[model samples]
Target: MKSCQCYLFRPPSIMSISSWVCLLPLIFYTCLAVGAKPASPQNVNVLSLNTNYTLTWDWDYNSSDALPVSFTTEYIPRFKLSSKRVVVWNMACEESPRRSCDLTPLDLHYLSIFILRVRANVNGSHSDWVQKKFCPDTDAAVGPPSKVDLGPAGGHLDVFISDPLTSANISMREELQELYYHILYWEKSEDTQDLRSRSLNSSVNMVTLPNLKSWTWYCVSIQTRYDFYNKFSSFTNPICMQTQGTLPWWQIVLYFLASLLVFFVLMLLILCGSFWCYRIVKLTLYPPIHLPKHFQEYLQDSPSSDVPRLLTPDSESELLCEVTVCPEPLVLEVHQPPPEDLEEPHPDLEPDIRHSRQDSGGSNDSGIYSTGGSSGLRPCPSLSHEGGRTSCQDIYDPQQVKMKDMTPGIRSQLIIDEGVLDMSV
Candidate 1:
């Protein structure tokens, strides 16, 4: 291998005057470009409460002739600053008119480090960025306790506090590790001169105030404290409570007994009222039947004697009549026949007829016939001629007829005339 000689080129120690003249204008232009830029923000700060972040800066605009200035805010991970590789900054607020911008939307982790920058913009130009270093875990402010409660414990008052929570609903104590509470209590009065305060350790969330006055009003307020970070939150809104005095054992027992007595009396009244209502309902639903006064009296008098009488009805008496009939007298009427039909009289009958005529003595003229006493018969009358015929009718005598006794239900009459008989009932 052949050895090769190496020579280092050396630059001139001094520059010419013409060269200086030529570079002077360029340098002046560069300085002017830098000087003409808008002023960067001053006193830049990052304020954090729990996980919420805000970037604020101070800026003064002295010249009214210049255009109105606006601010822009950005953030990047702190570790990326030392890396040679290019990394982009996250824009939190763009050209905002306000001096502060909310950085919570970036969701920066509490345990991670971040860098925040703010700059001013006027007309179209931007100033150099003003930077701040932030670690939410250490730099964030502890917020006031989320909740506060006051309770009475005999003569003491108990104060309960709840720790602040991050946006993730995680307790600040879990993240900070060294978290405590600062409690301030005072009597509810127009004057606050009698205020008292207490500080709790990281281990406990409750504090008891001893030797407090009984039956008196008190007020309380709580704040979160992080000793390691030297952070203290603003005090919470005041809460009011009233302390109670301890009761004697006898008084407590008496109260309990009185309550029991009242309850028992109420139950008794309810039972009595229920019974009364039941009785009324039963009476309304079921009714008894009563008999009429007259009917009841009649039944009680004599049921056996009155039953037959009650079955019979009243009516008018009936009248019975008996009829007696007398037998009619017999009447004999004789009609004379024609001469051609006449026959000779019998020898024995002529004698009897002559004797009857002799006894009659010719006094009878009605042509009635009657048997005389010679044969135990009534007297006979002479015959009379009418229309060229001789006829004879027997005389009727009411006294000669006999009246017969009739049975109770029989009504009849007997009549005999011209040898014919008729009976009617």
Candidate 2:
């Protein structure tokens, strides 16, 4: 009756306490092993410059776990978080040992919103993922201008700015769409503290600085700025240039006038030299003729002198005569023509004959005589023939002889005999 009456539930026993105590540690160990995991990544961030993107995070590992730990980076568009369907994250880095991963390969849109996450893994156990929100156009830092150039205008300076570029050589302006420039300029001789600033619109690439001193050196630096994100970049290196100076109008005019004056002076000198050269050449080519002094005097003295008188004899001529004498005295016989055979001389010829005898001086002893007449003449008969001599009379007139028409020997003989005659017996 006592066994039948035993209940299905057993009463408390003394050894049950130790068994329960031993089983409690085993249950707690099983529960602890199931719940243990690696620490999650912390401080997850995205670094962006222009088109370049990087994902970074921090993780603290337990020293007691001697095994190495690795990290994984993933990304998902922020718009996908609100979708009714299941959303999956794209892997940026898988089991990477580094704390940072390059996200540029993903080619994320600059205008789209993205969620970036990182996690830590060790010994086949993974930690929870930490996330950060990023937008490249808004969160990325702008960079300085790629290039800066300066040009000199008249009393002015021209600044040319180029947009910043990414590591891949992509322009920041293409991504930003609203890029601005901040310009700082100062004179090289002035202190940097006295720099002047200028802000340019997004579309403007060139700017002119007016009211600058001429021939003065100026330095300029430019930076990129994004107003939507309030992001400003570091300024570029200073570029030095000089402003051009302009000449005064009066100086230009003076130079022109001086050049014109020089040209005119040169032309005048050339003309004078040419004229002098022409005169010298003309004189050398044709010379003037002049008459002799004696000829000129002779022509002036006698305008109508006869040719014969002009040919007067020289004053240095000398007349010569010779006389001959016979060696022996001999008797001469003369043949006398009869008086009836000879024609009688005319009465008018008697004076001429007497004058001729005086002119001849009875020099002829051969019974031959000449009469100075154009017609025929008769010889006189011998008057006596004795002592080897004959007397002869000749008619001669000096006025009737034409000396010009006679031979030179006869004229000379007549001239000699007229002055003096010599006879020998």
Candidate 3:
């Protein structure tokens, strides 16, 4: 019965245009402040840990007026479309400026795809949710072999595997002990169906593939295995490698020795050719000297009446009178030696003379004289007249002359007047 008297409440009436103008700026500012929202988180990343996943993000406070932002995250199966959702709110990040959140006490499906969404609230103004889709086994599994080394070992491919990224958590460590490895390889030129596989225990990390074709390219992939769970992680990216070829130590040594032999032979040939060229050039540039036989004959010939007589240092008138009166021409006439006396031969000379005499018949000069050995002087057969002066002619022979110092300073003097000749005595 008392509710029948309920009265209606009404607000104050509109103010004048001048009063409204005064309140418009304050209302506008208040609306602007209330409507402003915090910027969405950027560089959102998720790191898988031994037993938990850490979600991290960053934002610039200077870019937006919204301050003191709070963050919340949600995870759901990427393929599931249920309307119901579950959220995990981070109280620590809401109270402080921390930018990270750790999700724990949950077991995620290893190979299942998941969708992660993150949103920020600044003074009850919410930002659009940032979403990411990834698989746990592919994006959240333990770190794979950090370093893989491949090399040739005794005509085989040697693969070295290490670093399965150890974990401090007891659960993760037990899982790691049960972890195995699957290795798959194939020839690059072959199809995908031609792949080959190998299973290795957890204790064995290194692998040796022997008897592989040399200089052939092969692609390889490796993945982690859980024997108890009967699960296998996604395969790692394929890596290409080539097997070593066959080369023996003896073959290398033989090659080296052959090269050295070739080099030595080439060097010897070059030296011999150079020597031959030098000999040829010397023969062409400098020739040997040889005298003709006619020159010796001319020197040995005796002068006849037709030839001019060698003039001696004597009276020309006496020689002419003798020649005109004699039946045969007077050969030569000599005068007394000059005032200058002749110096003795050098000390180095041995003045020994050897000669032989033979009777030559039917000649004015009856006896014939010839020299012997290397050094001697003798007169050849010649005509002789009745006068006291003998009419004779002698041929000079160079082999008869012997002097140790045959230098230019030493001289031999022979003088003649008409047919008459004289010698230094």
Candidate 4:
């Protein structure tokens, strides 16, 4: 058998100054590394709330020093031998030293226990990890569901619920599948109305309350229930709703008529606008025709048998003379006065001349013809004479007369009948 032994050597007071300086620094750093490393956290405890865990611990350190301080946390499923998982450090505890941290995202099953560990660090130095063990589902206090919504669905009220969750990704565990809903509703008035209630299954987030009075305001509230291991949540804030009653016939008719009238008015406006636009486009594309100025004047001439008074009286006599003159002269006749005993007593009376125009023959009985040829003849005037009345008659010319040289005024005045002129002037 063999054994090994070691001996200690002490430095003398006469050691060189350079050696003392280097050894002094090495000794001071060694003492600081051994004694000034941050202490492990103390009194590590877990505060388990429904679906969450709050971890807290105690530490003693001088914060005024320049030393940077922080904490690291980790958890294990149940027994000490299981591998540890680092709880993602919450942003709330990262900046400075923190004695407590909220470790959530917990799979809070009653049968599952979690072991948590926390440690402190100063600069690059770290201490041992302090450990605590607790089961969140069995230890955490219970809380109420977050909110509820109530609305009218036909003659009933539809209730909707929202529950708080510990983690973003919660699986369908048996404990989570046990939510129950209870609803209570009552009519809102002085007179008593029977209270109604309804219960719903865990999987249904919405339930309908039926058998409600129409046109009545009803108040309602809901509460949630879970396993007896957790306390029941408080009732949600109350809400009020009203059911609609049947509408009257006249009101329905009035609304229908109003809608129809509005539609008709809109259609009428659109049609009118379209018609106006069409007219504008047509006018732009194709304009109207205007008659020549002289043609318009010719159409405006008066229909008569006398010489047309074309010029206004205020016009110069030279214009009148020019209008009366013809390019070529034709034979014009004047009837001589009949003898004294045979003339008509009423000289101003004119014979009916319309029938004479249609007759084909000429009469020589009351003839006062100035020319023997058939060309020159005029209507006999009723002349005043010494004796009684003469019987009136007509004359016609069977031969056609060519219009040779009538002045413009005379041409304007001529009344044509079957290609014959009634006026000579």
Candidate 5:
């Protein structure tokens, strides 16, 4: 047997360094002429699809490197790299600059979490696998399409074809690559539990159902699927909704009447509001009234007058003129009774009085002393004045007391004027 020795040595001399420098430009040109690829491979960027049962891969190529035309995707149920492992297909990568591919983990062993990797097939020769640790996975899928909304919405499945949902939609994203979807329906609720209904597997999101009862609520359940377990998952929350029913003529009429009534009510409110607004605008633009010139002058000049004279007892004459109103006086007559009644003549003009005298005065010798009102005594005879003013003295009348000769107004004023004081200054 012959033994071979390997030598560990440093560069011998400056001669080698000089020779290498001289050959650098020629090497560079030759590489350029031949379109030579760089020696370093681009590092693979592995991404765990957020749903985490799946993975996608991409790479940033070294500017000097040649890109591989193909890729291979693979996964392992366990963390270890061992003889027992899953190998997905090797295929051409997307032709785009940064090559990418999605790999679904093959987990027949029913792994809760798996390890995934992507490899570039450089010239039909695979590179080292780039791996993501702990890719999450579940045996679950999106629930079934909701039972058709049979209420106000049109239950026609074809309606979705015409009007696509812009806001609420069924979207497939790379992050959710671990899951897929299915739709199913059955006459019996139990049939859906087994995922055995042939009515399922629709590509469209909205489903149009058949045999739904009119004006009745139905119990419908949606089930999610888990791919690795190959089983239908827990049923989704049951949805209950009432379906549309045939409209009776009376109902249709009632609906139209109700709609018309609502429209009329709204119109009436709007009309009233408009009129109110018009009145308001008119008030603002052209006020309801304009004060007289003098009144306006007074208002503009004095804010002090707003405090009324009636509020202050010590107000001046001008305030008194503005705030006070004088009430007219009422008068009653004052009469003096005649001496003893001899049957009075002109009885209508005379007052009749019945009197009793003290016994100290004899019967005819008794002088008459009048008591009570003037109406209790006899009238005095009329006296003719030198000025030709006839004065009627009805001494016995309670209703009228003769005032030497005063007019009703003056007499009333004389009685009432005694009690009051004019404080207005």
Candidate 6:
């Protein structure tokens, strides 16, 4: 395909009216001598938005002698900000040299202020930023809020502003009664403190969140506004917290069971110990007594007496000395006297000769002899059945009783009949 080329030419300064008619055909197809400069369009405003939103501008081909101007929409994010960016759109339409366009859901993350401009093109060329807007998104009646900050406490919100207003409110709607605000905030997490905890209408600048655990972290947003709902600006970083931990029901139940088990075990041990101590006490206090293995057999008299006789030989002196053996061991022997007999008497003297021994109970008594000296005397229990001599002369005096053999294993016990010795009670 072949392409047409445009050229520039200069026309003659003088031309006759009739003669010009013939040259008019050439002039019709010919180029103009000079082109005028483009017009300076009026500045357009970039509207502020609350929720993700968009703005559109309207312009038309109004210049009578000029060709249609092409329009391009340009946008900037975070105006006058360090993290600024430019955005482009493919919405170039060539209508009545007009601007008819739409923009929406402005990836709110980036888009801040927009600059819409139109360029007149007699040839393929661009104009300077014709409609420049330094403060694009600022409007007295309609604009986003300012000075927004973030909080980790997600539920409650806080907002700030430099100046005070007549009224303030928080809502999803952009238009409301004549209520302007200095600040606004939003809660993003669980809340615990009741709304009653706040004074009435005190929530105008400060906000509280809901559905949050104690000490849990959250993120909040805020700003200033003329209307109830508008975009929040000026933010701070997020804060953090560690919420309290909750124990499951199973763990509580296990703890209860463990405590109960310990208590029961202790009680059982106490009962068992008490019973054991009780059994031991009973066994000690009322011990079962039985006669020393065979002491009862000796209580009965023998059928015939074989016991030895004393040398005194008195008819009535046939007494037999009886010694007992207890389970508490002892040694049995005959003819021993107590150590008290060796002491001197009170000298209420009477010359001593052998006296006949008799049982006052009319039974029997035995007598002793001097084996060799006063220290080594011997005496024997006499059996009545011996039928031996009576009133023998070799009997020693009772005062001559001597000491006898000792048993290492025996602990002697003396149970004297003191009551029998006392005539007066």
State which candidate has the highest lDDT.
Answer: 2
Better of 2 and 6 by TM-score: 2
Question: Roughly what TM-score does model 2 have, to 2 decimal places?
Answer: 0.49
TM-score of each: 0.52, 0.49, 0.35, 0.44, 0.30, 0.24
lDDT (tens digit, per residue) of candidate 5 on 184-293: 43333445465433334433445565655565444444443436535443444444455566788999999999999999999999999999999999989998786785
Q: Report per-prediction Cα RMSD to one decimal.
A: 23.1, 25.9, 22.0, 20.1, 27.2, 25.9
lDDT-wise, the better of 1 and 4 is: 1
Query: Tens-digit lDDT track for model 6 on 134-223?
Result: 232333233333333334443332323222221233342233333343222222345555222212122254344444555444443333
The 10 consecutive residues of candidate 2 with the worst lDDT sum are 329-338
The TM-score of candidate 5 is 0.30
**How would the candidate models be sorted by TM-score, starting from the highest?**
1, 2, 4, 3, 5, 6
RMSD of 1: 23.1
Poorly placed runs, candidate 5 (over 4 Å): 1-199, 226-229, 289-425
Please provide the root mean square deviation of candidate 5 (C-alpha atoms, Å): 27.2
Ten contiguous residues minimizing lDDT sum, candidate 1: 333-342
Model 6 accuracy (lDDT, Cα): 0.39
The 10 consecutive residues of candidate 4 with the worst lDDT sum are 363-372
Q: Rate the local accuracy (lDDT) of all candidates.
A: 0.69, 0.70, 0.57, 0.60, 0.44, 0.39
The model with the greater TM-score, 3 or 5, is: 3
Q: Model 4: per-residue lDDT, tens digit, 234-288?
A: 6767788897667789989999999999999999999999999999998999887
Question: What clash pairs does model 1 have?
Answer: 370-378, 370-379, 370-380, 371-377, 371-378, 371-379, 372-378
**lDDT score at residue 326, model 1, on the 0-100 scale:** 65
Candidate 3 residue lDDT tens string, 340-373: 1223322322234311122243221111123334
How many clashing pairs in candidate 2?
1
Please give the RMSD of candidate 2 to the true structure: 25.9
What is the lDDT for 159 in model 4? 72
Better of 2 and 4 by lDDT: 2
Model 3 spans > 4 angstroms off: 1-52, 56-119, 124-140, 166-175, 190-203, 227-234, 244-425
